[model samples]
Target: MPTIASSNFPTPKSWDEFEDICLSVIKVKCKSTNFNRYGRAGQKQNGVDITGKDHFGFSIGVQCKNTLNLLTEKIIEDEIVKAESFAPRLSTLYIATTRPPDAPLQSFIQKI
Candidate 1:
């Protein structure tokens, strides 16, 4: 996880906080604040943590991975597969994490 540069305190205190940070990122990236957390903890969210439309009204989705280790290709692929069930379909699905990329995202899902 990314650390706070000023306070030295962890940027996110919990998994939910991590998701919130990712949600904010999605908002800024899409230039839209219309996104929201997808579902409650333990619910079947189809691998999406936060989802909504972008400024252009294209369906956008985000999956926050608060992994302790490097984010792996397999994990991303799994999430991409699960995201297929999301309603209205997604024009873009962003995987939010601090780790470096392990593999090409386009192989698992289109426009991700």
Candidate 2:
């Protein structure tokens, strides 16, 4: 597989900035302008950083992970567990991360 051009874009300086970027991208891709940041800092967010209905009018949740290293299965699983409680019952959950495309990780996520 071709490698991702990580140098093509600037990494976010903080978690908040990362989430903001993810929010913007989701808005454009999903064609929905009603999304908002899910929760304040230091609060339980049910694993969602940004959320709202998508273009299909389905409830969507996004979790922005700003980790520099690879995302562990445990981390993903834990977040999914938390997200299970999000109200309105999210029709879809997106895990947006800075981590590169790892085949194993991708496989694991796909199985979910």
Candidate 3:
């Protein structure tokens, strides 16, 4: 993971804050990165929080969440579908959250 320098603490208080943090990390990790939100600060993000190209030129889409709760199967499924719709097409989809995925979620991610 890339190091993120922020004025705010690591624990983001809002979803937008979490997204910003994820963007920062992505910017450091990828060859190039873009925050995909438009309109107001809390507007719908159209599924992607950050998009970038890795060092190897693979496109990636990232969705950020600031929840302590486990990511439910339904939620992951929905996010996966959303990521598939991202423009320019992504070679990889990553969910950036403070809490790590549980065993089943980890397995699901690995399989995908």
Candidate 4:
């Protein structure tokens, strides 16, 4: 099984390694759901760890944080902003972390 890692979270690793984990998770999730998906790593124009199109043809932007620690609201906000900047072109934005966010951060994400 693939896993995510980060300096701030669990075990720190290179960005490329984290990117790989993110891509793996997306692939597994999409495959399990029988969704046709396509992905790219660090595509310059995308400004995200991974970008993909689902079975329904909607574009998605994903940011992965490998840290074991809880994700912060600011980090989520920044990723959202980055996703929005790439918007209408991308239908949904997702921030995936190795560890879940704190209660406050989770609430913030729900509102975003």
Clashes of 1: 0
Candidate 3 error regions (>4 Å): 1-10, 33-44
Give residue 64's lDDT in candidate 2 (0 to 100): 91
Ranking by TM-score: 2, 1, 3, 4
- Residue pairs of candidate 3 with colliding backbone atoms: none
Which prediction has the highest TM-score against the true structure? 2
Query: Each prediction's Cα lDDT score?
Result: 0.80, 0.90, 0.72, 0.65
lDDT of 1 at 73: 69
Model 3 residue 75 lDDT score: 81
lDDT string, candidate 2, 1-112, tens digits: 4454534567789988999899999999899998999879999899899999988899999999998685899999998998999997999999999886788988999999
For residue 110, give model 2's deviation from the true position in Å.
0.7
Encode model 1's per-residue lDDT on 2-105: one tens digit a residue. 65444343546678889988888788988998999999998999989999999999999899877656566678888889998899799888887755334455
User: What is the lDDT, from 0 to 100, of the residue 58 in candidate 3?
Assistant: 81
> Mind sharing the TM-score for model 4?
0.66
On lDDT, the candidate that comes out on top is 2
lDDT of 3 by residue, 36-68 (tens): 433355756556777767877888888777887
- Every model: Cα RMSD to truth: 4.7, 2.9, 4.7, 5.9
lDDT of 4 at 49: 67
lDDT of 3: 0.72
